[model samples]
Target: MSPLPRFGRIADGPPAPAGGGESFATLLAAGGARVERIASLAQADPPGAWYDQPGDEFVLLLQGAARLGFAGGEERALAPGDWVVIPAGCRHRVAWTDPARETLWLAVHLPPIAGRGAIADQ
Candidate 1:
């Protein structure tokens, strides 16, 4: 197997909505793995943006704290160094973030599960 490459710098990604108070940077993308950097708000508030994708996602908090809102009314608070796994196609949004500090998140998008139905199912 090839050795993993080292990441020295983070690249800027798509711009978040105005007043949304969020930002992201893509770090890596390989055959079945991807890594990104995300920043956002610090308090529970609705009207935030949601993200859903065909592949599963894993997030590791690098700085600050925030809460994740799921489609099923489930909410999870995460702090720096915390990690979370989100199954493919699970509708989710940010519920809160540290207002004083920008929440930095390391997100990894993995390949979709094989033989699994579309993400809309579960």
Candidate 2:
């Protein structure tokens, strides 16, 4: 026997939050990897806060703009079609997001592979 197929569009999913909020919806989870659709509006990490995850995260900006800040003081700006890879245990935060528009993101979380230093693109 074989697994069945699944299909859906990112645009036809849930709407982003209104009045400055955020939402995360899981699209798929299998073999220790998870994919999600994140929607945000005028949202960011609080001051002096950072995210230290157990797995690597690959994030793609589908709509609007955002800025990511690292613990080492580096920052990266993202626009539509931009993407980034954040490794496990890397302290980072969402520094800024477009205040006037809804920002949609696709995030894939990958568990660390044994004997691998960096998470390669899949």
Q: Which candidate leads in lDDT?
A: 2
Candidate 2 global TM-score: 0.88
The C-alpha RMSD of each candidate to the native structure, in angstroms, is: 5.0, 2.2
- Give the distance in Å from residue 82's predicted Cα in candidate 1 to where it truly belongs: 1.4
Q: Report, for every candidate in turn, its global Cα lDDT versus the true structure.
A: 0.74, 0.88
TM-score, each model?
0.72, 0.88
Ten residues in sequence with the least summed lDDT for candidate 1: 9-18
| Model 1 Cα lDDT, one tens digit per residue, 1-122 | 99996656432444444455777666777797788877675444466557778788878887788888988788898887899878887889888887776677788888887887344433
Model 1, residue 46: distance off in Å is 5.1
Q: How many backbone overlaps does candidate 1 show?
A: 5
lDDT of 2 by residue, 1-122 (tens): 99899899987767667877678889999899999998888888897899988789999999999999999899899999999999888899989888899889999999877776566667
